[model samples]
Target: MQARQLTLDVTLPDGSDFDAFHAGANGLALDSLRALARGEGERQLYLYGEPGSGKTHLLQAACHEASLWGRRAAYLPAFLLRQGGAHALEGLDQLDLVCLDGISALVGCVETETGLFNLINASRCRDTRLVLADTHAPRALSAALPDLGSRLVWGPVFQLQPLDDAGKRAVLVERARRRGFDLPGEVGEFLLRTCARDLATLMVQLERLEQASLRDQRRVTLPFARAVLGEGG
Candidate 1:
């Protein structure tokens, strides 16, 4: 796999990309997703993990990289599917890469299943790559369609694990850098202790800090973090 540069932002919303994601102990998942983006590995990839394990981020990263590499790519999250109708899957199967997040959300929805099953079949015909991310493993998911359950494991599966504290710090710092600022280790530690400790919450903290810093023309120092975040800090 190519070396990852953690501060480089992709064109995707919220700067989602391989470069901005902290793989931590989930390096295998990182490598596999990068391979998927490059169309160099298994045609289908299944990723399952706990809520803050960065599943959606990786899926978005895959789509971002795929699009950058000139491959047609789409990321289907639950709300989008609910809004667009799973029939939208029909229009996406022709893309070079498709990532379906929150596959667990389709548990009792037969129409969604029908659309996705057909999407799977059509994608296979066109050699379109597929990546699926959910909180449960394929067999563990209480899917309404047995064939869909069977098909999910036809390729490699990776269980993405949550990052440790060190990993979280690195990720937050990198995220800050991508937003055009530096995050000191002490400032990051303060945020970790003063705000929500989860990576997702920490990320939200970083976003808020970035906006505050830009508006105030202040650097991301310990005092700035304290002043901007106030009670939260």
Candidate 2:
């Protein structure tokens, strides 16, 4: 199938890369994913983690890295793929790397399950690396199709560890630096205490703060963050 025919025309989001992710205790998993992107090691990898544990980030980061090496790669979340039906996955093996996120969402959908199974087989034939992620272990989601579960774990599996509070702080500070700002230590602490701790939410709030800072011509100090975030007492 021609690339244009496929429903998956996802563009990797900016700042979603290895450098943007704070590996924390998942250093080994990060290394493995980097190697997979470069086509240096295993052809299939399964990653499981809780929300905000960096599963989606790493998957997209892998796709970005693979493209940097001139390999065609796509990061397809199963939720979005489901919207286009199982056929949306057709011909994905033509790419060098495919990162399938939220695989657990495909369990009850027979068409998607079979399509994913077939995609795995076709990927093996084409030597296309596949990276799949879910919030649960392979066994936990295998009740509907044991064979598919077994196939899911046919290669290396890694459970991404959730970052600790300190790690989250570091991520906020580092990510702010990447966006050309300084996230003061107290501001980070205040965000942690007052706002949603999930990296996704924190990042959104950070962008809001950045925009407000630029608009007001002020630094990202604790007072400015409080005012921008509306967390003032």
Candidate 3:
């Protein structure tokens, strides 16, 4: 399909783009999502990993890239999608790319399974690319519908790896730079040692530090961060 944008109601979380992601050892997963965003590789992809492994970030990042490429895309979590019943999936194939996160939430729901099964079939007749992510691998997801389980594995499956200590430090520094400040190595180390290490939590802590530093007109020094973030730092 030709690259073209369409105005849609879906909203991605702020800073949820490819550049904000720290690849660490997930280069293959990241590259696959990039290709999918460009409409150039496998039309279906499955990503699974533990909490804080960046599955949701990568899914949103793919949508961000797809939009920048002028392709129509949507991101929907299966929990919310299930709440809307099977009809929620209607006409998803009309979009260039569709990202479904938290798919394991639909495991026991017959209606959602039926909807997704049909959507998968419809996607085959259109140019729609589907990216599904969850904490459990497809084989591990005891899908009530056998056919639906098989369909989930119809494309490449990648297990996203969590970032190491060095990677997390890199993420904090890079994100700080993007926000127009410097995150000193000592400050980063202090945050890592004190705050939640998960990227999501770390990003939130970074936001807090950024706002505090801007308000106080102070740099992000270790002492300043400790003061801003309190004893947690």
Would you estimate the TM-scores of all the predictions? 0.89, 0.94, 0.93
Sort by TM-score, best first: what order?
2, 3, 1
* Per-candidate local distance difference test: 0.80, 0.85, 0.86
Worst 10 residues of 3 by lDDT: 1-10
Candidate 2 clashing pairs, residues 3+ apart or interchain: none
lDDT for model 2, please: 0.85
The candidate, 2 or 3, that scores higher on lDDT is 3
Give a tens-digit lDDT track for model 1, residues 1-233. Answer: 11011112223476788888888888988998899888888788999998889998899999888878988777877665666566556566667888888776666688878777777788778888999888898889777876988788878999988888899899888887777889999998898889877777888888888999889888888888888887575
Give one digit per residue, the lDDT tens place, for model 2 in 60-82: 99988997898888788766766
Which parts of model 1 are misplaced by more than 4 Å? 1-11, 231-233
- Model 3: per-residue lDDT, tens digit, 1-233? 21222125456777789999999999999998899999998999999999899999899999999988999888887656666567667777888998988987667878878888988888877979999999999999887886998899889999998999999999989999988999999988988899888988988899999999888898888788877888675
* Winning model by TM-score: 2
lDDT, candidate 2, at 93: 90
Candidate 3 vs. true structure, TM-score? 0.93
Return the lDDT, model 2, position 42: 89
Worst 10 residues of 2 by lDDT: 1-10
Lowest lDDT 10-residue stretch of candidate 1:
1-10
Q: Which stretches of candidate 3 lie over 4 Å from their true place?
A: 1-7
Q: Is candidate 1 or candidate 2 better by lDDT?
A: 2
Error at 53, model 2, angstroms:
0.6
Ranking by lDDT: 3, 2, 1
lDDT of 1: 0.80
